[model samples]
Target: MTLVQRELVEFQDVLTPRAISQFLGTEAWALHSRRSFMETWVHDSGVGRSLEYVHIPTDRDAPDFSRRLQETASTLSRVYAISMGELAERVSAIRADLFFVRIARDSADGTIPLRQASGLIDSIEKMMKAAAIVTANPLAKGTGRTSERVRNFLDDDLRMGHTKRGSFIITIAARLHDDDIGHGADDPGAPEREGPAAANRVTRREGRADEPTIDFSRRVMTTLSRSLAVTRRHLDHSDDFVEFEEARESGMTAPIVEAIEEIATDSGGARVDMRFSWTSALPHEGLSEEPVIFTPTAIERAPRVIERFARSAGVPANTDVVGPVIGLSRDTRAAGEEEGDVIIQADVRGSVKKVGVTLSGNDYNWAIYAHRHRLPFTVSGILGKKSGRWWLLDDVEVDASFLIARQHDRIERLGGDAPEDPAAPVDV
Candidate 1:
């Protein structure tokens, strides 16, 4: 096979643009709350600035701080059973709003006008309280860990001497999948986000004409994409930290957390970790980095092709099967299926059967996805009962990235009512 192209691509996510948006939307309030936590304590002065007095000898906030930290930890245990490392890696990075920090800092120096400072303290406190409540919500447990981390980020850094004086921004870059063969404009392989920078409102440091408009989508894509298919071991929270027992009882998989330690490791490129410092600039130098490129050698052809078999013959009322498939034969007749309807064949264990499907109109995408990927398809209903293929489905789901793409495409055919799936950022 002749290799065509190969390169590293980095983005916050690999899911379809729409799913990524939804996932990011879920994390948005969490990010805002986490940032608010940092601002409350650190005041954005960077190194050596977090609740500076809290770590001192006469610190009155210590007890409450510790209690709150513990409270946050308990909330986390209730909802998220992920590991500390996973917690750190999966949390989104939200940059501090320097404006609020600056105003507060200036007030201390008597430079801020009384008008600006009057309700400012009240407003800040309100925001902090709101943030605390948001973080404590078990329904969005990821924020609990993020809240703790952001609240203590500066202090931890100061203790470790990793604190830098300037404001920190989150940066993103894609490391292309090592095995990614190639990408085309229309395919999912391309992670290039087609839009302005994720955050369009960039403030250029007076002399820095080279400032880059950061892409919020890029940051989001990277954050959520990295979280996919990854699962941490279940932790047993002691009685002191137990609150959401019902959450634990229901299990953590409903929110789509899975054990992807192996599959995630093999499938995607390295995840650009955003845990410690959320610098807005990635490693490629300048504001943003280019998408890593890759070469495609030769596409492997599947051994079999399952064509869609027409259900012309009498069919049993109950029959279903799932397994690898081949393309349909050309001779089959079509009922309600569209023009590209291919025959499908699945052999569960040892039973092999063939069948065709009349779909629920073209309202769903993946109209030709099976044909494109040739993956296993489940055949159920009354069509293939005579072939002795019954109840063979294992109910394993396809990846969300693929599932959404198929869904998004179908909804598009229904005219103007379909919501467009956002363009997804691929790698980094």
Candidate 2:
């Protein structure tokens, strides 16, 4: 498609010499010549055609720099049969895998509710971290503190991009390391130099011997795709929790399951759709481009899968515990004590038990609302027994959606003339 003038202008605004070089180099375009203020890159488009050259300005102060850059982009777009914006986006993510995660709901304007937005972002981060940890060590549990290596991968390599206005889309760019790019002569797309000797020479530097040949970005994406695929299939076919146990070796872990559960619940049961775009710099093998979706039914069944796997691992696992408020501890007299603490009788591991969970901040307020309304309360955390009593250990999220749903139901039942919702104080 021909790129419009607006598209060319937008691409020119962000295009730079370095980004152009990276894109050209990755696409196997050879460096033909270098001038004082400009560099020429040539690509041998096969099938009996002359070599094509693109002139890139080395200095922004060069004459007609923006016009030259736009011309270069337009030429590339025509040659590749793509749009200027597409070319620019590919260049921008030349060294990264672009991941798009969208919440597919009834929001025609592409905006999500304020409360669900925070929950969605937190869940997406958790989900990706869990995938990365599992990629580093397939046997590793998805819970507890992340290792130093995994933390570095997330902090340094991963980046969050601008949000899109298409049903609440989140863009994540996972930067590819040196090990991720292919540079050997064996690669058909490897950049070739001018000389015969340089034609066979590797362009990019080799990674350290200690580094794994497979980069973390690709591996993590693969693990996430496979895990979500397996969970969706299992939830579709079986009611037995043993299926999760069987799928343990397939990267089905507690944290990923819990993360999906939280995301689905926080979206008010909307399906989560995730799309992965592999970087063009390297060869991607056996990874599907099809979107991975976590349906509402699968999410509803996720809690059991997490609980079953947690039992097999013999450790405190993350899962959602939902039930009515059985008791509350308002005693703030003790040291480090706060009012509005909650105790709920929820079904845990096949039997009903009283699960105690401490609350503060918005969570404390939500607990009070649920108790006053006699609505079911849901919280996710590490479920374990302490002093013969069950307690949610860490990272407790007091879901406020239940209160909202209950209030909505009450309004409907009262012929649309119910009192103001008590849950209105909480945004979620």
Candidate 3:
């Protein structure tokens, strides 16, 4: 069977909530707590700063942090398992004209940057390793050997050192999740929902199996995105340090830390909250008139078209393509639809020429997927003329440089990139 066929088969077993819990070796509720903790820590710890110094002053804080960390570790264990589940769900939704395509060739070649994909794989691997280390020698768990390993990977390997600082922020934040619950039980707030009458309602509601459920995946994704944002700020601080060191050599008066403080204060405190929103192209009966067709043929050919396009773009033929399958749509007034503008399009030739590529609603969907999966895609490429036409040209060049530049700018702005020194004075 072809790679597409293989993916189709694999998608049958995609991730589910119960499966995710099993893979992570933790319950959904516990994972939620862990995600909350990480997000909080990222917010509290100024970017680029070490998290080791953050103190959990109270016994309550200590237990919360420990519990959250433990839960996170457990959840990491189930990464692959959960991924399988996700894949399975996607496959199940595949239509006759569309199926999952594997770019194993591009992934293998260094053409596509595998950093993000590798990071994700490595995250799961490291988690497993950590689990092994913890289980094999339980004594090291408290020493944070596993946590340290995971943190170091986030810092050194992923070039996300700021995230390590944010981890502490998460630790602190986890305490807040239940603070209201604990406080309300003892002390009531104005117009409180914790009086005797409220208590009876709460007790009554607890018995309902269908209490509004939290979307754990969304929660986790949001927490991680926010953590990345804070980490990006910390990275900026590190860059500032580099600048400070260079300035100091030139007899500059201010210290780097001071500069950081000044900037932080001026900016109304250095805090980041990365927001992500998703929209589905799949037609909603009430809001949209577009039809979402799920054809197996489309699913089977997408990967081939993507791979061909990647190859035509001069990217390596070997690269692992992995991530959530996303569909996208937009809201525009009926009049706006009449406006014609130039849009870059993708052309794929050969047997896969008719293949269609489906993308999530917003550009960020692809960006996040590429970032998380480490797929180096041409940000600026010719837009497909029709909704899903494919072609190949001898010297097809797409000016995706703009997209790349934008991505780079965002990364640098968020402090994900090392700071560049101001161009030295040029000799006259």
- Best-fitting candidate, scored by TM-score: 2
lDDT of 1 at 426: 17
Top-down lDDT ranking: 2, 1, 3
RMSDs, each prediction?
26.1, 12.2, 26.7
Model 3 alpha-carbon miss at residue 116, Å: 9.8
Across residues 1-428, which tens digit of lDDT does each residue of candidate 3 receive? 65434433443232222222222221112211222123211111346853311111112244564444334322332432444334333222210011111112222333323433332333223322332333334443211343553444334322111111221110001001111111121122312221122211211135575552322222222233322233233334443223323422322211111222222222233231222222121111232212222123323333333334344446542222222222223334434222111122212221101112322223434334343444443333332323223222222232234345555665668777432521111110
User: What lDDT is reached at residue 162 by model 1?
Assistant: 14
Error in Å for residue 425 of model 3 = 56
Candidate 2 per-residue C-alpha lDDT over 383-407 given as tens digits, one digit per residue, 9 for 90 to 100: 8644334578887877788676776
What TM-score would each prediction reach against the true structure? 0.19, 0.63, 0.18
Compute the lDDT for candidate 3: 0.27
lDDT of each: 0.28, 0.68, 0.27
Best of the candidates, lDDT? 2
Q: After superposition, how far is residue 16 of candidate 1 from its true place, in Å?
A: 28
Better of 2 and 3 by TM-score: 2
TM-score: model 2 vs. ground truth? 0.63
